[model samples]
Target: MSNLQNGFLLDDETELKTLLFEGEQDHLTPSTSRLLLESDFFVVAGRIIGHSFLNGGPCLVGLSQGIIHVLFGGEPETATVTESDCADQDVREVIRMLQGTKDLSEEEKSVVLSLTLPWDLPGVTVNNRHWLQEKILLHAVLERTAQQVKQIRRGLKDTGVWEFFSSRPDAVPVLFPRASEAEITPQMVIDNINWPKDEDIDEDILSLDDHCLIMSFLRRFIENGTSDILKSLLTFWTGWGVVCSNLEVEVIDCSLPQSSTCFLTLKLSKNHKNYEDFHQDLMASISSAYSGFGQI
Candidate 1:
């Protein structure tokens, strides 16, 4: 039995810990963590997958003080996340170069010809002895990238941190932005984010593995309120794995047809910290919620 509080009351820390981490005690499987850390691609894959599973499930988890201290113990880093852009590049231009195909913009045709469909141009003919082998090589490369992405995400969900954050959306501060201007603009800052995005988060973000930690630290004060869930997310404890340079939460309103769209902007530090400091931020944020409710 561990001394801790959950929501509006006290709960055993050991029990909650058991519920969350006990499964790992049985035995260690193939050690994939080492491999995941070795590459940027794998890290990004984990972030996307973690966000998917966490967002797909309920929004809360039981955390303990000890873990909280370890997870959030660090200075906040300032980091920004944005989407990859390929909107303007015409598909036809790419085809013209690759196989001299006349038609472009055929997402179906483009993908197929780019991968499986073979062409018989001046020197390159599908009937050529090595043509089929070339196609196979290209397909293999694409498949590996796709497969790696899937595995990275799967690993994130298995970590349990994803589950903790997903359950407590309110605690973590969420924001969404809609396209409004002729030119694309970032939608919401973290303080203003009210919803999650359709696409999964970057794999690198989840690599930090920061979640459920906030609840663990402030279990005594949270007691069973929406604020507890919020605390679990925003409390700084969850940013451990990412190298955060700064942290900020602000709210802003915009005037546009998509005005209702909300955005949540967050900047995290890049370095990892000990558990003790993480707890202070978690508790402070939860306490500030009631005392400084609208100040954020």
Candidate 2:
């Protein structure tokens, strides 16, 4: 599943372009490359996504909501297409122009006509501008990539999950989540942890001041960390981007932070005199793990 996820998200070996999709990060749509389509790449991508979900592995995630709607058999006309969905900057500018109440300037008219002419759409007029805007948007977001979308549908069918997707509209977000929906929160991390206990007396480790202080530092770090930090920490602790069911934290006698990814355990040294030292060590540890440098 990890390999599948990487295969879809990583760059192509020959061209350094993304393997299956394109556009801004997290707003991806299926690639419309003729070469990729001719090779049935989208179909295979769909199958990988379905298989990953069925096997309870990582989701493809970070697909455009509009594209996800079309992928699951929703009408393209009904799918919302904001400027963000249009990868072309000029097209996005055109979309923004269309949303205004002001009449198009001569230059703006020329810009709009240039785009629409290629698609055989009519030039904008006072009476037809609204309709033309809608058409232009649809063309930019969906029509241009129609074949790729169709192949994805076919691929999903091959995996025998097309019916499930078509029937479960709610499942769309789960399989291909929006960027905001996929963000990891500090509470999410805190909730999944299994704090250590005093083995000698069977007492709660939280009762110890050093353990409490270390845990406080961990919480503060997570709360203040960037999204990359959260993801790196998760990967360092669990050997995966997603959180584990039972993350364990143990206060130890060492000076640096350490993790056993196999056990989902983060070992924090209680020797730090202040949060600054703890934060630095923790950052180094997670950064090393994220970069495949192993524990520092």
lDDT of 1 by residue, 1-296 (tens): 11111111214554332111111211101112333335443444345434533554222122212222112221112111011111112322332334543433457444545544433322334344244434333233222233343443354556555455445534332211111211111221122333222243343443313322322322332233243244334333222111112332221222100111122233222221434564444344434332242232
lDDT of each candidate versus the true structure:
0.30, 0.76
lDDT at position 173, candidate 1:
25
Question: Worst 10-residue stretch by lDDT in candidate 1?
Answer: 79-88
TM-score of every prediction relative to native = 0.22, 0.77
True-structure lDDT of candidate 2: 0.76
Q: Relative to the unseen true structure, what is the Cα RMSD of model 1? A: 22.4
lDDT of 2 by residue, 1-296 (tens): 33433444344466443546656767777666687889888878778777767755557766777887887778998998766677778887887888789988999999898989999998888888878878887887798888888887887788888888789987677777776776788878888987655553223433466667778898899888776678789878877677567898887777678888888889888688799999898888888874474546
